[model samples]
Target: MQLKEFSFICPVIESAVVLKAIETVTSPDAIAQTLGNTDSVEERKRKLPSQLVVCLIIAMSLWSSDSMGTVLKNLVNGLSRQWTKLGQYWKVPNSLSISAARQRVGCRVMSQLFERVVRPLATEETPGAFLGELRVYYSYR
Candidate 1:
């Protein structure tokens, strides 16, 4: 309405490409391992498996503006990658189902996944991360 109210918003990039990047960073095996570590592995296949739920959580960050149902639909529908079942699983679950899946997986899986993958991004040679010749200790607390 007003010139002062105008805001610039960044456009979303291709969904498949972003999903592939996420797959690269968080491989299937790594996800399964984290699930196992958290004792959250599913006993049998379901509408939404544990692994997909894990990925769904990551995808949620990328599609933060969209609803969970829409996000999951985009995530499942955009899997052009050859490794996945793709076309066979186009039937996206409803929001309540997704919520239940999220509940079943619980928070421990994500916490364990974070503990598994997240590490120091800086090496010993980085400028500000280290002192002149010694490593600097940075604590969050």
Candidate 2:
């Protein structure tokens, strides 16, 4: 069949349901609430803001393709754009900077952020149908 002859549009009902589900999963308030409780002070120096760092960590997690090197590379490529958008308050760390940040904050912070933000986002029932598919495909195997 020719490309033009085939229907390309998704059904409106499915699309609306899917979109609403996605919105619930990625809601900003959910993100803020999840990251809000992170400790803000360490060794008497201010740490990166929990909310901002959580945002960065989430982006990094999404970009990572199964390796630390890949995550660093993706962070470098998108760093400038993200920094520009987030303003001076958000610093895009270099390779060394990432190493330092990781050392300073440790893995616990990132792990907590993931559990708080990404986990809930994945589990919200409105979004569960799509996430169920992903879990079956990626997690169950």
lDDT per residue for candidate 2 within 1-141, as digits (tens), equals 212232226433233233233234444455445444455324443334333344445555444443544554343344434222344454444566555555655566656545654542233354443654564223421
Please provide TM-scores, in order, for all candidate models, with all chains considered together: 0.72, 0.38
Clashes of each: 0, 0
Worst 10 residues of 1 by lDDT: 1-10
Best by TM-score: 1
Residue pair clashes in candidate 1: none
* lDDT of predicted model 1: 0.77
Q: List, residue by residue over 1-141, the lDDT tens digit for candidate 1.
A: 222232224354677667767766677889889888888988987878888898899899878899998888887776545335545646877888999999999999998888887666567766688877677777633
The global C-alpha lDDT for each of the candidates, from Candidate 1 onward, is 0.77, 0.43
Return the top candidate by lDDT: 1
